[model samples]
Target: MKNKPTIAIVAHDAGGLGGMEIHLNEMIMRLKEDYHVTVVASSLQVTDSEGVTFIKIPVIKRPVPIRLILFAIFASIRLLFVKRDILHTTGAIVFNRADFSTVHFCHSGYLKATGGSRVSSGGSFFRKLNSGLASFIARTMERIVYRPGRTKRLLAVSNRVREEVLADFPYMPEQVGYLPNGVDIHKFKSIDDETKKKLRKQYGIPEEGHFLLFMGGDWPRKGLDLVIEAFNQAAERFPDLYLLVVGKGEREMYQKMVSPSFRERVLFTGKQSEPHHWFGMSDIFVFPSSYETFSLVVHEAAAAGMIVISTKVGGVEDLIANQVNGFILNRDRGEIAAALIDILSDVERYRVFGERARARVEQLTWENMHRILIRHYEENDQRLGQKALS
Candidate 1:
């Protein structure tokens, strides 16, 4: 292995406070100890403490077919000039390079999967037009980027993501590796009951109230509406039960979902800078998301020793065992409500599950993730070297 491998990471928006940004930032912070990392991003929204160099370039959110072609051309040219051993693109778009091994980290293929919900800055008409245009652009770009005949590795954040990648691009199975996102267990450990009560008081949450915490950005995809419905159904049984949503998204849309009777019980804390504080105050962590590659919030909740209730979707199955560490229910609202009631009714069982969840998540820290990533980097580098000799 090289003493210090030079690595280049590419993402659409590097600074945005989302799952991708969180993953990238954690990886960058850890990888900088062993590798010289450079980040090439479309938009630079956050600053890194590590001395990794960052290059900002224009990225098209809804580029027409012609503009997308130009974007790939310019991106490839820019990438070629950066002398790096590995070209790691954090999303779906592959980078073409014969000399260096390109790694594509699959986030989502929303453009290819669901082409209808594309949003644009130019308003609704432009957004709808952009969706149609995006499909063509994505298809064209994929063709050019993957046509070089060099087998580039693809990293899937979850098994679901790997299946999606295979379904979308059948010819690249050999290049795909499943790497689920991890959480910082040390930072999210359970607080004492006294501390939890203090935090609840600070947040204006009743000390005895059962607070259901939902943490994520895309409220719709995270099934906030379904969560609201389930909470409403369960409210009659447990009057002190409240739903606390912590993340960034359209507030008006979520507001309309809450009935006037339960309006006081629903609290929107917006995007939290440090979410562990809120997690400390929470009674149970609930995630009813319909779509997710890997739900990091579930892991975070587990680490915090909170009773986790999630839909059996995405990478959750890998981490959560029903009635063991956490409860994973079906997508139906009734099933979710039943699970919530069952857990709430049995305090001893809930504590046992929460403790088990914490034990399971204690192994999934950033330190462990860093080691695994480093191994992948070194192994891939050696494989590339062998290919060169062959």
Candidate 2:
């Protein structure tokens, strides 16, 4: 019998929170059965990696600049000596070139979009300095590793991301591939009314209100301010409307954004480990994010049978048909408020929206995504005169 080919995946963190970490975890689980998987990360949350080899990349937790630079140096040094048939990584975390690199977010594109002030815009002097330095390091590394031959293939998380990659590196159109993130359909299952009520009570939320969920960290970037203002406006007409804000952001700062009268109706659950339950507890998912490669929560929301109201960012354009399964609105508060009113006005008729949304994302399972990823790996392998590893 022939030995399985070894595959190396490098990242700062894997099998943990956030979209990119979760994507790596999903790929690791599926790839381990057929290949010898080696995960090079600072921290890992995957416990099922029985046959997988773990290479720990020591890094500091605080001060983003130190952490980023340390990981890049150490991880790159380790990659130089590691033996593997294929190499994969998320973004430009290391100095060494990779066989496959997943572009979760285009920092260079973001800098251009936000005029080189995305992270260092409104923070303290030290915060601004740290973020600015971190951004500089990441951009410099990205520029080096995304050159024409630095990577074999660039797996973009969305069509939006694919465009960003091509815009930044127009020379590598053939090397960039559109590979949107997949949702775990089973984990984010729809809940019945009884189950929803029970969950609301468990979370200390009122059981008798129409819930509007705004999830994700980075309150400003995810448009929580828009969601809060819009919810305030919508709450005026629909008295039963309630808002649920999840993820770890500036809670006190955003709580002030809510109208005084409607403040009591809003609840913030700080940083949930399991967000699938939160999706099941809400009726509508609201996101007015300024930018995203692909918001995994939106797909999870739709999978959990929630009417998704979001801006035209990430995979949303591909997932939503206007006024059909969801509403792709602008970042304006009035537009978001109006869309909320339109959907909540007729709950019974609009209930079909969630059903249709679930149906739309039913086929976008991790297993399906894994198959396509393996096919890509094998195709790239064939081009390099390697045996089929699929």
Candidate 3:
């Protein structure tokens, strides 16, 4: 006869292509199973919302800093009337005191890492200004929201992110939780040879060659150019090698980085929604991101039974055991090339690497992540009950 506990999730956007959007969508899906979920977002792309209630928050949609400011103001005002047992939000998007907060990226940490430079410092003037302004706004918001007693608990997506949060809010060490992002293991499992060939044929990828995959947007930060250079070096030894690039970036600009003989081998598939298909047809996954809280794509690639070569960024160290399951490299193109050559030159070794990589990430499922989150929620409830009793 008791009513289900209500949970209100607050974000600027509920669903879309980005990592945070996808995380919000997955969390919403899992929360809806038992809780009466309410989503307060500017725009939502989640489809099956039979049990969820959506409260739209008005936003500017341009000059991103303005959009973030407007959303924070309006969402806070909206939250004043919305009743919920738990107030869940992402980062510092709102001013209201929240029961839970998911910190995906630490703006303050990024500024610290980059020597107080904006992410787009090397970009055009307009881009540099916009990124600088956005970083400033986000850092200011974090200062206000991450203070003691403002948020009951903060869930960081990686250990690195957790450290950064503690670095900024040293007083709230016990309040910060480390939960690495999860991947859908079933959706990205190892495929049979027949299935791999079928996927290659379907995607128009050359079936005769060994494929290496580089997936993600923000080409510069993700080190797509470095991958191209590494692939070029690897290709000199193995002409049957090919690189599959999925996601957003200027293709022509990167194509120039490849030698004329190997340019055609570097296939750019543009933006892909279903990355599992590409993962199925690939043999190796290479990602050289300059920085990350957690690179979900690398984990997904490992789950898909691909020999992974990635930099020691984010929680990648948690997934890969260098030269055992996978190789963790520096940002140097030569090192990436050496890893690629080492993997490609050996058949049995690479197979073992892929299997070990898959085994490592198979346990990191979305279901497990949801369970951990639920545990956090129940722990909060227990604390509240004890406080009330006292």
lDDT tens readout by residue for model 3, 223-254: 99899999999999998999999998777888
**TM-score, one value per model:** 0.84, 0.96, 0.95
Estimate the overall C-alpha local distance difference test score of candidate 1.
Answer: 0.72
Candidate 3: list runs displaced more than 4 Å. 119-122, 383-390
TM-score of candidate 2 against the unseen true structure = 0.96
- Against the true structure, candidate 3 reaches a TM-score of 0.95
**Which 10 successive residues of model 3 have the least lDDT summed?**
381-390
lDDT of 2 by residue, 1-390 (tens): 146788899989988888988898898998887788898999888748788899999889879989998998999999898899899888988877778898998889888876667832355889878878888988988888887577878989888888888999745677887677889999998999999999988878888889999888887788888899898889999999999898888788889999999999999889897799899889999999888878899999999999989999888888988788988888899999888888888888888888999999998898998888887787777632243333
**Residue-pair clashes, model 1:** 2
lDDT of each: 0.72, 0.86, 0.86
Worst 10 residues of 1 by lDDT: 99-108
